[model samples]
Target: MVPQRKLLKVFKKTTYLTTFLLLCIAWSRLRLFFLNVKSQPNAVEYNGGLIDDIKLMKCYRWYKNCETLYAQSAVHDNSFVLWNRVSKNMTDSSLYAIESNWLYETFFYVHLFNTNANKEDEKQPLADIAVSRDPSLVPLTVLQEVMPSLRSSDSMMGNKRLYYQKTSWWYRFWNNPLPTKMNLMNKWKHNNDILWSKIQHDSCLITNIQLYLGSNFVESRPFWKEIIHELHNEDGNSIPISITRKVECGFDANHTFPKNTINNKDLLQLKQKSDLKILQLSDIHIKGNEENSAILGEFQSRIFISRIIDIERPDLVVITGDILDGNKSVDYQTCILNVVQPIIRAQIPFVISFGAKDFSKYATQQEITDFVNQIPYCLNKNSDSNGHLTIPYNFSTIPNDSKDDYSNLITQNDLAIFIFNSKTSKRQFFKDYISLYKSPPKLALAFQYLPIPTYRLSGVFPIIGQYNERNLLPEGFDNDDNLINYMHEMNIKALSCGFDHSNDCCLQSIHDIWLCYSGATGLTAPHSIFMPPSVRLFKVDNIDKSITSWKRNYNKIDEVYDYQYIYNQPKQKHTPSN
Candidate 1:
């Protein structure tokens, strides 16, 4: 009778307790969200510190992490925190999580905002805006500044708590463990860490951050504010003093050689000691898509070589790969041997390697053996021809045409070019026509046919044979080994091969095994369909055993393969005749 008199009051008390628990959960979530936001701000930065599309993607991912964390804490546990003004009122953890998720979606729009900001930065007359408006760059950089708001409190929610939770006994029936804020926080942390690293390295980010904050993001913004105010006061004019122009002043150092250019004294001194000039051409897929004008452009291989020979007058030419998109038996002889080999003939001590496209997918061990036997001219006039193996032009006159004496064809260096032959995924289709005849009709994967892998795989494996990561070269091939003992090898200081086109080239090791790639002739063949075509000139002073790269890029389309090397420099400056 006494309980019945106050049933409503008892029910209200129980409900209040439940609501209080939920308030605690929401608060916990808020703490977790703050920690995540605080830890990941650097990840959203690009260039090594922050500023790029990848960074934006990373920010969006972090925001998504915040949503997932909320959903997990609410759905997984009956016990959770709440958003309370003065610790009296309570809110449901589930509803709070849902609201937090709404914030997540709202932040996703922030991503779009950042992307648009970047796009607008690209489209707008940044220079004019920077000069005309005192705070033109600040509005665009607002997003970077705004990110810190998410990290207001870190301790109550503690940064580490953003990542996980133990499953309640009631929730243990399901296969998956209870979701925690840490899932997204951990991922965001990883991504942001990468973004931070990248942004730290980026010059644009550095300069911009310097412009905005002066030294740090927060400090730089205030510094820029003062700078803008000062810049506007210079002449009492609306237009501010322009630092934007200064930013772009030294953007391209390569083309803008100084009138009183001081060459690197050591490099210049080395050049004086020995004339080591090299011609490097890479990623030249000859038989790619017909519309892919890169190959057609490179068809002017003869013209470029002629120009380079005239200009550089170098001793050697090194070709990396895609010698002619030879994925099949038909393409090797027709495109590569016919198109590129003629141009290579102009240089002495020409070294080359096999790109992936040169191998046969259907080739058995015997077929591979035969393929290697015809190594000198893997795909030449003699390939699928009347009984005669193809010979290099310089040594075509040598009688008794056998594989052993094939190296005798070249006049210089007393060294034989060991062309690597590696197969690709499309090799099966190339080796046999049946795969193409199937119902699905195996067409080439548009991206895979570029032969870039074949070029690199073929080029590198031989250099670093079946060796462990640290120990390069296969058994018996290492220095002071059985092969060295048997062959009495002398003066083989460098092993150079090319393919894997990149103008920003590198040497994997010292001269013992030099990994060199002669940038592509057709910039449009693979992923570089948008970039300008480029090439590298490698010069090696045989006496000094020194090598150097003269990287060059061409804006004009026709000028791509229209020049040659002379002493490791372009023979003629390709003036647009049109």
Candidate 2:
């Protein structure tokens, strides 16, 4: 009887526990179902059309005023306004009112046009509702469906706000004296009324609002731009700030590429002339505006280059690499612009021989090539792949008063100019091209970034300019003499390079081939203070059948120096001992 009672009790207890478990499960399922239904957006009915209603609602004012307020605050404070809402519980209501303008402007249209309203006849919420309520609680998915740009704006604005917050003084001045509540409210209301009036007057579709807001959000609330943001103090030095404007957006359409460009016809005309002057600029290590001081800004490099271009007025310009300090430059595009703008403005045809330091983790060689291609008057052929360019100017006949010594070598009075990327290992392309020619042209000049092995034998050979740094060859060519031997055999008259910043020497190697450096042409690069920035100039006189080279320094007093003949003057019979 006792065992039977115990078994009955156990069964009853088990039944009770099962019933409670089932009830809990059912309750949870019901709760989940209700939550899902709540999250789902309700169907909206448009009286005219969804687009027309949005246009009538003047929702675009929200976007325009939001962006306008953001820009104004950024300009006024010299920093990005914080996107997150300030705590209302704080003691300073005036401060809160002033600082919360961005948030109010950002969501004012959404609140006024509240598509989330349950019924078509339901009155829309006031614009200030978004400010009163916690912004995070708002349904982002619903907002996104109405205006896709809002999501992107929210994301970009928040990120920029946080980034600047960490570095800006505007965010740190919480304890500063605040305006009286009456004055703050009056100013706020006035600003709000102005924005409201503007919104009521403007009519735009939802798509237009999205487009305007999306495009201008990043532009208005930028964390970095071509112009560096800094605060001026009593000492005249500025305290650097983190906020900046959009560089691409700041680019003026009026800054078009120069119209002057060199073509086959132009080259032919130049060939007809007695001489062709070529300017070689190298090691222009532009590290962006921020990395440099006010005096040494990237703009200063452009100014210096512009001044030199005006003085030299060379027919052709060759930039021998290290055009950008990729690792240090905050903006590679701006850095590149600074370096090329001067040349582009001057409208001289130019080519680039990329150096090892021209690209870094931030900027790749392909990116640099693509950017350079956008500018006019640039003659870089295959700049992205191997940076190989071959320009052959074939004349109808040799000059009327030509020397007999050039009869064999100068078959057609053709002049050939080859630009190679020393950073590349593939020489087969040039080798094949050179093989096609039985003999070299009357004058052949090659431009590259790194000097050939012959340059290392500077002491052994007769050099014209200063030799300060040790010679360096590109990788994969350690103790390699193949390239040097090929150039010598091909009768390539001059090989100009620019990796060694301090070594601007033109060494007369065996077979009378000249290896020259363009020197460091930028202020930011590590160079001797004694040796100012300079460009190497090559004057190829077709009439003289000679190449004369010299250096033009930045100094106003003694600009030109190291004047020497590169080819067809006198042969130095010196050889490197094995």
Candidate 3:
């Protein structure tokens, strides 16, 4: 990590092209200032080359296996299907994702940089430009300063000047220099090296999560080190997918709810017709028009998704936004078509919801709806009535084995499937809904952005300090109580969201509402959106009013491949409903 004031530290203006590779390597890591090699008993040490080598090996091995599969796919279909090339790109992106540097456009497009950028220009800090994809890798103090504090009581829509203060463009423009290892070494040049090492100490959770910033202010988690160590030892035959059970499953044992917490009662009594199977996919970012490679990468997702749909045989498919890369890519329509083309052809009743990404200056919310509606079976609508594309769930139509296609078994009655236009805060439906809907609409199940509060995130994956006070709910609501009250008032059963790529779920037990995350489904142009490709399956039991979720991995090879339960609270019906 080079200092912000020191521009062109490694490569001079004239010699930049000659030292292009060297420059990227320098940009990738802090080679100059890692002096104190602390002898911690169980610490996975990091260096510039070791990190890159281990990450690349994992990536290449994964991609190689996919190539073998691609070659085999030719046996099934001889045609050079445009979308068939998507998987290879997915693997390649994951490879670049681990190392973090190789994925940069600057690596290939050296021309993108202005070698002439001198001291006077005071251009954005390099680290600022390349906002590290994995926050776990950045220094804790930097993360503490930069990222938003998860507000527990703040409204969905509030006048949050402080929230944006640190993360604002002007703030970052002024002070975005992440302190690094060099900063530490320089401080103790004449002082005791042993004292500095003693101060920081040997903590696995602290040390490995960070890159070698010029200073040693940040710490990395033990989990990532374990991932790298496993890969380092492997023969590279089987590229290990970063999978397995969560570090801290369920809620933290230590933290208890306040005494004023609402009492639990079995309120969800369902006259369930039959179990409904829903397939959820999100952040399937496609940028084929940007590059031929992107086309291949996105198509791989299509094939993978199609296979999962065939196996799971979900009755409903819900793509919870970010279908297209948020850019002026001509491939937006093509990408959406590719993702749901099989489902469309199969006539599986599916709905595509909008996210903050879907509506940009380049593509409006209505345009996105219109694009998907082109597919006959896609139940996406754009209207002023009710809410935009709110597909009411029909409880009358049971999952009929009598029919050949069970997906069509669901007839629309009034199950809450609303596509909220986050862009249109002015819309009456959204304004009231955000404030608080007067009454619950049908059997409420929402598909929207802004995840259900991160109260215990720091405890699970240990962050810098005691409390990670961070909340991501959009502004306007009165407080956190407003959100909880809204759910209780509406009998909100479940919410499926997709802005964050990480797979995380938690049950907010006010009315037994489940906050389900359908992690990054596909890879695309921006590497920040890269996570191993996977989708989630939800089985909603109307009879008992119980909703259970299972994750289905695409490239990730895990022992558990079935629909595993994320939350399985089936409220036993003691008394029969009228």
Quick one: best lDDT, which candidate?
A: 2
Best by TM-score: 2
Error of 1 at 201 (Å): 75
Residue 115 lDDT (model 3): 31
Stretches of candidate 3 exceeding 4 Å from the true structure: 1-273, 290-292, 359-365, 382-387, 394-415, 424-443, 452-481, 507-511, 525-531, 543-545, 556-578
lDDT of 3 at 65: 26
User: Against the unseen true structure, what C-alpha lDDT does each candidate score?
Assistant: 0.31, 0.51, 0.41
* Regions of candidate 1 where Cα sits further than 4 Å from its true position: 1-276, 288-296, 300-305, 326-331, 341-351, 359-496, 508-514, 529-531, 542-545, 556-578
TM-score of each: 0.28, 0.53, 0.42
Model 2, stretches more than 4 Å misplaced? 1-272, 292-297, 382-385, 394-413, 435-439, 471-479, 569-578
Sorting all predicted structures by TM-score, with the top scorer first, yields 2, 3, 1
lDDT of 1 by residue, 346-456 (tens): 424443444444443323334333433322322221222111111121212333423334233333321222222222232232223222222221111011112221123
* Model 3 Cα lDDT, one tens digit per residue, 1-578: 45743566544654776678666644422321121112223322221110000011111222222111111111122222111111111213333122233322100000011233463442211111112122223322222333347333222232324212223453245322221122222211100110011111111111111211010011122122211111211233322222111011121222111131111111011123466677888887765342457656776777777788778777778887777666543334445655776675455667776665564344455556665654445565333444355444446643333223323333323355555443343145534543443444446666655454532233234221112123365564222434545554555567667666655344344455655666678755232333466677777666665566667666663323434343355456898789
What are the RMSDs of all candidates, in order? 24.3, 17.4, 26.6
Worst 10 residues of 1 by lDDT: 213-222
TM-score (C-alpha) between model 1 and the true structure:
0.28
